[model samples]
Target: MPTEFQKRAGVFVGLVTCLLLPMWRSELYCYTVLCCFILGGTLEYWTAVYSRVSSLQDWAVYLILFMVWVLPTMAALHIYGGVIGHTRLVECLIIQLVVGDSAQLIVGRSIGRHHVCVKLSPKKTLEGYVGGFVLTFMYGALVHGWSPLNISVVYVFGCIGDLYFSGIKRRLGIKDYSRILSSHGGLLDRIDSFMFAANALVWKAFFFSPE
Candidate 1:
């Protein structure tokens, strides 16, 4: 029997392969992967919202919020990959987000003492936040020569993205979003930070020289 960590690692590798392989091989595959993620995330969002709310009036508000929040964030990937033809750029962003998130988890579990937000995300810690921030900033600088603002957008908004989903889960009284990804929960849970970082930084990349 595999332990929880093993299950998580397996799923993580598979997910990364699916995402990066498509980027290297074909644009169609990339879009296909994105569509799958958007559809899965949308369904999960709908499930959580629908289960909690009863009134159509309340549903209307959530529906609108969904359109506004989810679509634009996810579409940022398309802007980079499809519109900009910057697949490597997307790849770098994905790697940084993944590494930063992994750093947060590892450092948080090992030496984290002070909680960042006990109510929104009890497991998050200040030490973990700093660890992720410093490491991601350095890595981004070395790899992409990204500006401080760009690095901040990726790290800070990544944290915000995590907390955003966490707040939703707390409100809806559930965990993991869905059991689709074994120990890692749903696709949305895994890519929440990426979605937010891309959405926040993609436009900046368009307007200014990040290199």
Candidate 2:
């Protein structure tokens, strides 16, 4: 019986090896990873919605699902494949997100005192958020040359994305979208914030990037 941390670490190492080994030689591999996220996320989302047995119409549910999961994923593909024509920038963003998320967890547990949203996410705190933001900014600025605006977009929308999914889970009366990943819930649970931030970056790059 593996512990939760072991499961997480094992999966993470495998994923990193797969992504980094062939990432530079072939862009298709990266797209495949994104597609997996969207597909898994969509399934988990649909399962949650259907299980809730809401009074909303089927069309309404589908529309919400498309907007929340599918649309953002498509937008991300466009940004990375068509618009930017490279995965380097997005890779940096992913690294920053990982760093920031870890920071938030560590700082929140260590010294966090004020909850950011008690109703939506009880464990999230203002101190944690600030710590994550500061560290993310430093890493992105120093290592990736990410502009302040880009860092801001990722941090802000990442928070929004996490809360948005948390809201869904709260409404659905479930702790996770699925239990596929052992202690980590599901693929969607891990990449929800990344998906949202990626799509937000898509729009920013589309309208703002001179390239």
Give me the candidate number with maximum TM-score: 2
lDDT (tens digit, per residue) of candidate 1 on 151-197: 88777877888888787778668887788976678877877777777
For candidate 2, the TM-score is 0.86
Q: Name the lDDT of candidate 2.
A: 0.74
After TM-score superposition, what is the CA distance of residue 103 in candidate 1 from its true location, in Å?
A: 0.4
Error of 2 at 120 (Å): 0.8
lDDT of 2 by residue, 62-97 (tens): 558558667656766766666655565455445445
Model 1 TM-score relative to the real fold:
0.85
